[model samples]
Target: MQLRFTTDNADAAVLDVEVKELVIAGWVGRDRAAVLHHIRELEALGVPAPGAVPLFYRVATNQLSQQIRLEVVGEETSGEAEPFVFFHRGEYWVSLISDHTDRHLETFSVALSKQACIKPVAGHAWRLSEVKAHWDRLELRAWIKTNGDWITYQQGALSALLTPMDLLNRYFTDRQVEEGFAMSCGTLSAIGGIRPSSEFGMALHDPLLNRTLEHTYITGSLPVIA
Candidate 1:
């Protein structure tokens, strides 16, 4: 994927990132109570509970995209705003992304549901070191369009989710995160409830730096012929 990198002191530079590995880190809430709450919430929607907390699901690298529009098989998909970390040229960068999933398929297999939609990533990113000092304060938020209006979908501080280092350590116990690797951290619960929408917006805000990375996309549902 091609992304633009910008730092506080440097100009933006566009680089091609060869992401050889892609992993979706799910059920990564730092608070066990909150994690259980999310599980129950999914259960209410017919989605089964995860076999383990902080489960790692490997996805195809080709599923990553930087597009403003997406097309899914049906209207049963929704987006989750997440903070993603990627390694390129020996440096790790943080950015915002939406882990859009097919809700219908989620009930049968969470992993397959995730692979059912394109993962939309922000076109720009910040060096992880730039936000590491105040990582907990960084905020993740998302919005969905419903009934002809955009409404708050999900909102919370990054503190609610496990830190990137913690996730990397758990996934790569004996090795460092290889170059050309990317992972989308877990997301916050929806403001009202999880539901499908035609449009979604996501953002990662650095309060200390007074800057934000954002992306919005429209989902076009194709007919699910029986």
Candidate 2:
């Protein structure tokens, strides 16, 4: 997929990124309890502990999508949309992505669940430099449309997750994603327990800049034949 981003700086030029690969980075929360809560959920589903908080999963580049299809019934799904970051032209660009997963498969194979569905991504992004200074001023939030109303599913400051520079230094020290790769920086715990929804919305808000990058998509499920 192609991502187009513009900075809050009116003089900055628009950035066009050709997405080549996706690495769903997980367990990247500042609050260890938040990270543990996710691990515990996976454990309940039978996924073994990895002895770590931050981990990475290679997702097929084709699985990336602007819309998501839920192709199974027994699948318990949830959207872990967070502030997505990628590198380009000697800088990092920020966007939004949902690490949509099959909660059922999460028990048996976190790897398989990671590959099961198309990840949802926003079409627009922002320059990381624009927000890096007041990084804590950035906020991330997600909502699920239910019963004709938008309900808050997840919400928190970007500070809750690792900083973009740190994540890059630790995992992509060699600039693995330098040519253009995107990763979801973990997520906030769901307001309610994780559950599937037919529609989802997400946004990255910079109160300091008084700007927002937002998008919403409808989820369609295909059949799961047993």
Per-residue lDDT tens digits for candidate 1, residues 1-226, read 4445454545436646888899999999899997898799778888889989999999988888887887999888999999989998888888888999999999998999998899988877888888988999998999998898989999989998899988988999878778899999989988887899999998899899899999999989999999
Q: Write the per-residue lDDT of candidate 2 for residues 31-51, one digit (tens) a residue.
A: 778678777776876877765
lDDT of each: 0.88, 0.77
Q: Model 2, which residues run further than 4 Å from truth? A: 4-14, 67-75, 174-177
TM-score of 2: 0.88
